[model samples]
Target: MEEAIFSKLRYMKKVLLIGGAGFIGFNITKFLAENRNYEITVADNFFRGKMDVLLTDLVDKYKIRVVNADFTNAASFDQLDKDYDQVYMLAAVVGVKYTEEIPNELIRINAFLALNTLEWLKTAQCKKVVFTSTSECYAGTIEAFDYQVPTPESVPLCIDDITHPRFTYAVTKMLGESGFMNYSKVFGFECTIVRYHNVYGPRMGFKHVIPQVTQRFLKKEDPFKIYGYDQTRSFNYIDDAVNGTVLAMETPDVSGEIFHIGDMTDELKIEELIKYIGELMDYKGTYEYESAPSGSVSRRCPDISKAQKMLGYDPKTSWKVGVKNTIEWYVNYINTGGDVFE
Candidate 1:
């Protein structure tokens, strides 16, 4: 009996999350730890991803291995095992603020991270990889070419202006999408790409719209300014996004496929989102409408029919419900003196 148990344990699936300490990464780690029996290792630089109480609790409870290293340096890959059964590449310098403030660093870090991972994958014996991308890659297509709403994955990716700083994030993601796909093809390993759309939830840090709105409401901003009031986006709660991502990793015969994981039915305008959040926060404040910042997409929603049919990806959380849950969490966290994280 002891020998049999040892053999089974030896065959357990080994998983690696390259940037697994961040918002989505930590959630994915928690989900897998709770639901699956795989041996999980999280490698992150701790730059943006934090070593907060929540992560510490999960790691301690699940006995998940944590490797702290800067992956942008190619040498850091040496710290991870090469025989993982599954790998998740979620590392990137994301955020519009960064694009506007430090576009050069954004390009350099994201590009090097993708390239280094690809070079490492060339030698690693991992079975499959999931590269998390963003809807920004095709945002230019919608704005510049009048692309259809509820956009499909088949939509061509275009940069509205190569010289614009805002396109830096999308440009790097495009490089990742191409680099991971082609490298996987040549390296004889399976690969899938997931383009996430406005994924938000509790503990997701304050850089996103939801948390920022929650903070503004907490601060009791009178006549709260709602930027991009006319623009629309379909928000995908973190739980639903995690489900789709795990499905992408575990499903069979799906290599080389790109799936847009988002809630198609929950698309709402910025004004609607802000007002709803205001209501949730019990804000009896007036509102001011403002134009969206430059380079912001006018309308954004994904045609998730592909994810639904191919991966059985269905998002269950309504925007209102998700927003309420997110707002509540942020309120509590801030009330209890939670540190602001990016």
Candidate 2:
């Protein structure tokens, strides 16, 4: 009986996470490792993902397989097994800075990454896949056409300016969404698309708004500049985002469907977010209002009713509470001389 049980456990469903070392991917890996018994493999090029202590610790504890290879090259797919039960495509060059600095490279890397993965899936016997997307894809729809505030998955994806560098990331994501969904249709596999809002939490790297705010407060900038102070966003905590993604993958009969995985209830202004962080950091700093960066969306909030109704998905973290937890973690990390990774 003992030998039989061990054999069954060893042959359980296998899950693959492409680009699993990044902030959201790593959190999803951790969640699955803690809650499920499935065999998990994390394949990442680490372009932005780091092979740091946190990741190594999880790998060691759970015996999770980590594959370090550039998935941009079609040849790299040869390194992976063809029989994965579920695959999470979370790989991308994601950051506003990168869009501004190297839009060409961002386009090249993200487009090739999605195309290569889709081609690989055409032949691989993967059962299901979740292609992670972003709210940026529909930002132009809202800005140009003034679409619904709590946007739904059906909203038409548009880019305000194709010539602008800021839209580079959105363009590639649009490609991924179309490629993954259509490929799965013709190729006879399962596929779901999830567009995430501003998902923030601990260990999310210093490139995002929350961490950048934390770093500024740590430096004690006297007049804290609040860019896009009036612009609104619904920030989803990392844990909630991970839960939604898992549900999208595990829930049946949801293939070819797109779900907006974000907290619709936590919408707040950029000013409110910055001021709250200041209060948390105990900084007596004055505020400076500034214009939002060019091409930035003025407002973004997802309509997650579909997810809630279909997958029973609900986000539990209030922005204030989530922000507090994130701030505490960043403060502790910085105080302990934590070097920036990713």
Candidate 3:
């Protein structure tokens, strides 16, 4: 993989988004595809991402191509047609709470994809890889319950204790990062890891808390019905996350490095988030926070100083604005009989 300037990429073009059909992948792919800067290939097996939810027209209009392939296998990834100058690995079994219920599957899926993709990318000589990691990598929170602050990357990442249900997802992702880092050092592969906070917006899985709340609100039910409304979460707006991804991909001298991509200061109580969602949706329902699931963390946030100084990145959209955009999109989707938003 070569380390060329961002402007130079225009001349040497082609991008392959390994899981571009999924949630965050789709967003990143959409941004690049819309600009028609690179001939984009969106490959996915649809294990979690649904083709129906994707903007297929963008493929036609922008010359974006979609291929069905599983990253778990080296052969399938090697067979991919695109010669990518930039590759974004956004495929994974996302969501810590969800991963807790399927730890073995999560470990298998996350680990294998990282291994196979790096192998294929190395074979393809693909340059400038952006691997989307997660804040869950910082598993155990050391701060007192009374302390309201975002967790920095320097915090203790107790990957050794996967027995702690909250640590399952983080442990798997940590392994994935290690795989990428080792491959980069051994093979000189240009890859950057960005640990995303709670990224929420359109096309995310309904199983995710944000979309679940929106769906419940639209169904005329109390949307804030979750366990422990006091649990804190810093929600990263979709565009902000997208911006960070682009910045990381564009920035030089960041190869083989890791950066936290999120708004550290935008912490919101689960209860407050629900009420905000309702207000955005014009929903009239009681905001109720119940006891959270067994593995749910009491607090979740990110320290984005590294991102700000290095990538010149900062979140532009307020929670209110982001939620309103999400709700509007969901409402239109529902009106169009797009049950997929659920």
Candidate 4:
């Protein structure tokens, strides 16, 4: 019986994770390697998320293959195996900071990554593809058109102002959504889209609000500034996001479908989120409110009912529990003087 079990493990599915070095990709890779007998290959450029000790440990433990290449270049896909059973396309320049600083570069890199990968799939023998996306693609629709809260995937994507640098990220994602669905239909590959909503956790680097807030508190900012304090968002813990993503990939007969993978439990205000983080950090500082920049959606949350019904996706982490765990990790990481992010 044990020999039979080992035999099954030896012939597990071959999975390829493009940009798997990043936060979401890394977690997904880890989950699959430990929880399932998957022949995993992580392809990454490490432009934003670095190959830190954690990912190195996982690769070593799982015997996973690592391909280091900038996927922004069209020919880079050749370095990867065309026979992968599954592909997770998570490569892209993310974060609001990048959008504001280098919108043109964001558009260029993201669009090319999507297009190049699509062209590769046209000939590749992959059975299914899961393309990671963000809810920002529909931010303008909800804000401008007053779309339903816990916004569904059916909400038409909108660009409040194409000229605004922030919308550049959304524009490229919109292109990926349209391009991948259409390309899959034409090219005969199973594809699923999971739009992540405010997914956050430790080792996600210092770009996001939670980490930024922790840094400010640790720096002893006497007057803590809560930007977009009144604006609200529903935060999805990384574990929930990873699970939903895997479900979208593994579930049967779900091709050409879009699922909003996020937590709809708490639509907390920005000020509320920051204060909770501050409380965890034992912050006794004063607080101030600041305005969100242009093109920033005032309110956003995904209606995850579709994912719940179709994929059996349910978010299990609460803001308090998730925030506590995240704060602990960042605090320990900072206190240890780890220069991994640098």
Candidate 5:
């Protein structure tokens, strides 16, 4: 008789990481690999993620395994093991402006992947699931700062009622969260939701605000040309987000509960952030400011009280520290003339 799938792991703790090659996924997998407690299996398709980011040398050294797969493909699902103690779904077409332009494709990919995972999760006996959702699922606001930042999970989602441009990303995220929650309710999967706010750090795409600013500065051109000076976002360090995700997984009562994960203390302005990056890079360039696009939010901050209260989650990395680290990575990447996409 054939051995049961995941049976080899009965004597050892193991975790399944979907999209484990992405920025956040790579960091989480790296943490798990170093701790050496859990055998890690990472599945990714390299869509928005780069395979090189996971560092094959580290993978080999740590005995981490990778499966080239996309969640949308049924054949891909066939390759996945039927048993895992924990499952983390971090696969999605990410980014705000990028997701906005391709709303239909975004919805289809996210929805299909959620459904596919639901099927696989039904057959697999896992202790808990960590699902990453975005704060974009929250309703659009005219005054992000005047109102409580980091809107809580209890805040009503306004995606269904909006006719605005940014709603494309918002609506789909809401649907994805709903699908996951429903499956957990009916099928009894222990699920936890983390709505991440502007998660950025090493390995993140250069297109994100921080990297974008750094890149422009490195090019010896104006770094503040792209958007309005008023726009703002509370950047959450990737490590902080990863820690919160693991915490969510560990907390048993968080089954079917949603929490926003981000740094609540800092709210940096876009123009100011750019200037800071330029200073870090020591770039002498003209600051050319422009009006932000229509879809840009004036401000966005996470209310992380629930995360702190429920899961004992707190962001230890300050914005200055996170930015300094990100800037250092950008400088090295630029010095080597490494292609961000490569």
Candidate 6:
């Protein structure tokens, strides 16, 4: 991985998803397999991601390739071909639990993943890449400076407390934004960034708020506590997130661009979201508000106008509709005794 620019990559029909076994990654994999004719490969270690029945079924039906390896080591790139035309870089350690409990390991893994992938791109003849980012990168800007609520990609990335455990995730993501942009500039690979907001749906795993709340309701907690009652966030359904991601990948002549991909129309408070889930579960629990954990952004949402105007990205799923679909899936999975990581 030299600092020098290499020869231009030849355009072709192959697509590579670096973290294709995860929730959003799997959805993107399915989309490309059904809608396009390109050769598709999913390379993932499946730490948080799963190699479940749905993914296995998709691979069997579509004959897509899967490479299982821990990608924290840069040499893992040697196992892959270097001639892909489209690359989706979605591999990273995500979720608040990991950031809080294992901040050092989280930072090490994420920074290594981003840096290693960029190094691989130095010689890998892959063209046109989309790096999936998070709205958390700009969360400190919004909280510290009273920045716009429906935040856009242009907002400066910041970390409120460099020493705080929770901000570790955002810090690594900021490194990714800078790493990908600078690498692409030097290497001449077309790159776009999409900072995902609160994207959630079925199979989103138990680490996120939606599934955790659903689990609590299922256990029939009498007095359910909403951690961040007043904190508001816009939830983007997985289908919409997948659509926006593909648009960023396939849309032409848009290099070195960043788009905020999330629903802005249905931003709601934490309590509102939880109570809705409780209602859906027919729970009769009283609600209480506890303080959100340290370094938690008071409020966050993305302004996706740039995405809509440039990429023709229109997210159609309402929060209620998306949550209903997600809740039903969780209920059915649990009722049928399906094993899930909590």
Q: Write the per-residue lDDT of candidate 2 for residues 1-342, one digit (tens) a residue.
A: 999999879868899999999999999999999998888999999888888999999999999999999998999999899999999999999999999999999999999999999999999999999999999999999999999989999999999999999999999999999999999999999999999999999999999999888999999998889999999999999999999999999999999999999998888999999999999999996999999999999999999999999999989999999999999999999999999765
Local distance difference test scores for all models? 0.94, 0.95, 0.76, 0.91, 0.79, 0.90
Tell me the tens digit of each residue's lDDT in model 5 across 136-255.
766354243244555778876654236664666667677778888888888777898899998999878777878777777767885347477877778899899999998998777889
For model 5, the superposed segments whose C-alpha errors exceed 4 Å read 1-11, 141-147, 160-165, 222-226
Residue 138, candidate 5: Cα error in Å is: 0.8
Weakest 10 consecutive residues of candidate 4 by summed lDDT: 333-342
Model 1 residue runs over 4 Å out of place are 1-11
- Roughly what TM-score does model 1 have, to 2 decimal places? 0.98
- Give the per-residue Cα lDDT of candidate 5 at 48: 72
Ranked by lDDT, the better of candidates 4 and 6 is 4
Model 6 segments more than 4 A misplaced: 1-12
Clashing pairs in 1: none
In candidate 1, what are the lDDT values of residues 1-342, reduced to their tens digit?
999989879878899998899999999999999988889999999989999989999999989999999999999998999999999999999899999999999999999999999999999999999999999999999988999999999999998999999999999999999999999999999999999999999988889998898888888998899999998999999999999999999999999999999999988999999998888888998999999889998999999999999999989998888988998999999999999999
Q: Can you give the lDDT of residue 192 in candidate 1? A: 99
* Candidate 2 C-alpha RMSD relative to the actual structure: 1.4
Q: Write candidate 3's Cα lDDT for 1-342 as tens digits.
A: 355655667585788887788888888888887664677888888887777726676677787778887778777875675467788888887766556577787778878888888777666777778888887666444432233256665665554355765565677678778888788788776889889888888778677776776778778874447567788888889989999998999899989778888887678888787777777778765665578766556777777888898889989988778878887777777778776632
The number of the candidate with the highest lDDT is 2
lDDT of 6 by residue, 166-237 (tens): 888998989999999999999999999999998898888888888888888999987888897998889999
lDDT accuracy of residue 124 in candidate 4: 96
- In angstroms, the error of model 5 at 130 is 1.1
